[model samples]
Target: MIKEANTTFPIHPLIKSRWSPRVFADTPVSDEAIYTLFEAARWAASSMNEQPWRFIYAKRESDAYKIILKHLAEFNQQWVKNAPVIILTAYKEKFNSGKENFHALHDLGLAMGNLSLQAQSMGLAVHHMAGLDWKKLQEIFNVQEGFHITTAVAVGYYGGDPSVLPEDLEESERAPRKRLPLNTLACEGKWIEQ
Candidate 1:
């Protein structure tokens, strides 16, 4: 079963099960699920419909897996390498609007959000890492200079074994974290001071 079935997102019940964990079993991910996840991300909203997000991934048994794994921060590398897939999420700098803006990063974020939710629906876990080594990933994937990586996503079946994950990560994997109160995160009514 997935965690926090009642997610804040408007996603369906199945998708809400998706959660992130550093430790994943060596089990492989099916090609069908990978295709479907990207397909869902393809339909995510983008600035001016630019759809700037792009994904590059390596399956667990592939040689590219090692290269991608090396790009992860030491903290993440400790466990993410055990997963079945290592994915680099990126975005093209240029948009359909003929402008070079930072909106692509935001667009990429939305795409990842869609992917995470979709993976959960399929009984999968996607551990995303923003603290990875961007410079190494760019070189490892042979990405062009203009385009840049946004995050690294580790996808696989959750293996709740405490031995595989660091003590801190293991604690998180065991239970759901609390969210900030709506009153703290959400703003209400007029912007003017009372």
Candidate 2:
């Protein structure tokens, strides 16, 4: 089920096709493909080359998988249960100078952006979620004080039947993708009213 983006400006087919779908197929992404996704993320541009991004991922049926699932909000768990892989993305909260790394979350977003595009190119689907227990996740993974879990990603093929989803979500899953206009999204120098 492809829900291509409705973009105002021309964009790469990959960008148009990349979207976070709630339904995932019960298929296992190959080890090599998974490695390639992370490789793409590893090469994302970082702040001062800090490369603070870190990931903890587990394949389906792994003991760690169950634990990760528990940290997701009940709503996420409903659809994520079918994902073949669940990944936790984290990053350092501060730099070595004890100053806050304002770009930490931005860097994580770049990494995930690379991962998402790569997944789409490989005919895979990736759904990133923020509805997670970040605090409990830190405890579960033994993440240190300097590191913070920022997001969770569910990756797999898109094959789930929307009929099984609750009516509200089913409607959402089938809705046309929407995005802000380019002029509203970006401007020349000063901010312009939409």
| All models, RMSD in angstroms | 2.8, 1.3
- What is candidate 2's lDDT per residue for 1-194, written digit by digit as tens? 87888776789999998877787777788889889999999999998888889999999989988999988999999888878999999999888788899998899899999999999998899999999999999997899899999889999987778887889888999999876667776777988776
Q: TM-score, each model?
A: 0.86, 0.95
Q: What is the lDDT of residue 173 in candidate 1?
A: 71
lDDT of 1: 0.79
lDDT of 2: 0.89
- Lowest summed lDDT across 10 adjacent residues in model 2 is found at 179-188
Q: Report the alpha-carbon TM-score of model 2 versus the true structure.
A: 0.95
